[model samples]
Target: MELKIDESIIKAYGFTHQNINIQQIGSGHINGTYLLTKLPSNEKFVLQYINTNVFTNPKAIANNIQAVASFLNQQFPTYLFPAPLLTVNGENMATYNGSYWRLSPFVDDTVALDTLSSPKQAYEAAKQFGKLSRLLNGFDSNKLQATIIGFHDLVLRFEQFENALANANTAFKTKAAEEIEAAINYQYILNNYLEIKDVLPDRVMHHDTKISNVLLDQNSYEGVCVIDLDTLMPGKFISDLGDMMRTYLCEFSENETDFSKINIREDYFAAMIEGYLYEMGSILTKKEKEAILFSGKYIIYMQALRFLSDYLNGSVYYPIHYPTQNLDRAKNQLKLLQELVDNEEKLQDIINQSLLKVI
Candidate 1:
């Protein structure tokens, strides 16, 4: 696809290379991303147009990235983080043609997979995310801005779901009645966040922990960096780990239509726990450790609620390919949630065993 980005925008970043080549890369659902390669040196960088529709305040997002990157640079210089590239004006982000843009030097010799190709990949991704949390344990979370207001506020999500269900058209409500009832029955799972928020210490969380967000070494498959810092903000550590569970442990993507293919992979779950607790085990309090397994249930059900809410409300929030795509996604997540519930004991056992190993 041809993008209409201006050459001046590229030049503003001040690349010293003589010739540059830019091409779109990745399967990102949000925001447009391109890989910029400098000739001769073959050094590459990532330039992205911030999706303003999803993020209303580009400056706030830039500020969050800068803060997190600055802290990480000082505390863990060896860690690979995609720090934002500054423009000639000395700004992390620039406004051009009424759109926001940012740049970051690409991590060399690393690959980001759209899905987990192996249990090792799952473990590596989990370890990197967990290590990131551990590194930021001392950083002040309140100083970070909420790039997306109420991004992970479960109480607000429930309220929005309730409003959407109440205001839903009769035909729409009737069609999604079964899913709505399933969501209502599982309100307790979503409420887990409220119960644990007071006990668990709030820290910097990478709210989006999908496998694609992690970059792995091309040869060794070792996870090198945790990219996609748009959703970096103050939140529960479980939410971040839960996202790892929701995305990595699953046998299929959330959009898969075949419900039978959506079972939680027990091996992947075990690997994730082993990798996560390797970094987080000692730091997590008794209460936090106890709540570890349920984190998966919480995030999975919360996602289902969000999908169902959007479907009932005429799919305003998420882009839908078909009329009932959101409904299908809702059912997919609910099915995954049910599988996670069925295997809750087994998952808890894995967590306990992994914790034992670390201890």
Candidate 2:
């Protein structure tokens, strides 16, 4: 559990070791985050260590972050992103202890997701992300290389899942075979993803759009800034919306293990669409609107399949807490997918209502 940030490296970068205080910050499971505080002046920074196991190329990831930040600085001055603070050599990243680390000024008046208490908060969150999408239209996607190839490819993901199932030696695979088959069937609906991708206005999207990535002002539920810009690239708005819905619409707590406890928040879904379409209603097409529900189902099913495959392949992809952890996760996600399918009509109505407001 020890993070190997050296004191000498801090001093070498012109920040005194005596003044700087670094403490671990609770981010997601993938990467490590540290809230760095400077004494006397009391300046703060977020020093993040890139998860090398997941993001193999540190240089490319740093470059991608730099590109996005540079773009934001030039284009949208009001929206604050995590702008990397360069070192003495004018480099934003530094290699230390067989890992990559970077620093950025810590944004004040910011709160990441604990839980969405009201519909208004959810609506505001969605609206802010829509604004983000509207603002980032027509950026150069060539600059951001896919650090993890086949990340969004549903077909490739299914092949990997099948391989995992075929290779599994455990008895768990026997009981889960039916659920896996159902998930596989749903995978077909997403087969023509490339054909339908044009519906949603494609641009530089925050591919990993979870509520935690947005920093909301304490006083106002309005989203202040979208942080964690590592996944910004050329993807459909549906990818962001799908990921956001996947994370936000779940009623079960993060620690919930039982599949029966899972539920999808329809009101939450409504608020999310309300928030999102508020910013980019004029830009979205009819086809895009029609396919939004499919996007939600596809992404959720994709995650479940991915988790199951990783589990069957000896738990290499995601860190597992228990023997049945991955299986439980897959089941929970499938339940979420089922709920989304059931509420498809209401979800579409929400989108249409939001669109009418914007029009």
Q: Pick the lDDT winner.
A: 1
Per candidate, the number of residue pairs that clash is 0, 3
Return the top candidate by TM-score.
Answer: 1
**C-alpha lDDT of candidate 1 relative to the true structure:** 0.87
| lDDT (C-alpha, whole model) for all candidates | 0.87, 0.76
Alpha-carbon lDDT of model 2? 0.76
Cα error, residue 30 of model 1, in Å, equals 1.1
- Which tens-of-lDDT digit does each residue in 1-359 have in candidate 1? 34667877787887632588888997987889999998867888898988888889888889988998899899999877787889999989867888888999899889999888789999999999999999999899999888899887788889999999889999999999899999999988766677778888888999999989999999999989899899988988878888888898877887899988988889998888888888888888899899998888888888998999999899998888899999999999999999988988888888889989877
- Which portions of model 2 miss their true places by more than 4 Å? 192-195, 198-201, 253-255
All candidates: TM-score:
0.96, 0.93
